[model samples]
Target: MDIVEFLSERISEDEAVARTLLGDRTVSKSGAWYEQRLLLECEAKRRLIRIVESARQAALAAMVSTPDQDVGWIPQSLQWMEQSLNALALPYYDHPDFDQDWFRT
Candidate 1:
């Protein structure tokens, strides 16, 4: 798949994982919960980075093989990948509250 499609799929998968981690709670309240959540997020980020890196390398390789005019898509794709990496750095959930259950049912 293309970089945009691949990143979109990864984003959806990450959101699903977040939902599973949160369960019935809108926000995690336990430190342990946050820790576990961070681990999952980190793993997701790693996967995203890997995909982006691969796409970037492939784009660079393609730029060498194809005609200059036809290779314009490479820069745009790289920009999109950069933006995605930036978005991934932002926090998705609120701080722990210490009032909810440590483990959701």
Candidate 2:
């Protein structure tokens, strides 16, 4: 189903099991919850990336093959392209240890 529901269901299940055994430390499942959240987030993001990529490809095809290139839809199409690029670029935008030279040819 939805990402939030999937994440919450998994996390709640984990927490319930943890509570039955761990007896509540100071962290009290915070670490486990965070880890689970991160895992779920990654999974959700993967699905989202696939969906966005499909839409981006469709938009690109439309932008390339359309006859009326001088219409207002061009700007909207450009905006979609930029947004899709930015969304896909987010994962690589920051890396504390990755030097710029590593990315250069």
- Best TM-score goes to which candidate? 1
Model 1 stretches astray by more than 4 angstroms: 1-29, 90-105
User: Candidate 2 lDDT, tens digit per residue, 4-85?
Assistant: 2433444455456555444446554776576556556655655765665576677777777885775456557656644653
- Compose the digit string of candidate 1's lDDT tens values, residues 27-89: 547844774675576567778788887998898889887765588789899777666754653
Residue 105 shift from truth in candidate 1, angstroms: 41
Candidate 2 ranges with C-alpha deviation above 4 Å: 1-28, 69-71, 77-81, 84-93, 96-105
Point out the worst 10-residue segment of candidate 2 by lDDT. Answer: 96-105
Local lDDT at 22 for model 2 = 46
The TM-scores of all predictions, comma-separated, are 0.52, 0.47
The lDDT per prediction is: 0.60, 0.52
**Candidate 1 TM-score, true structure as reference:** 0.52
- Score residue 78 of candidate 1 by CA lDDT: 77
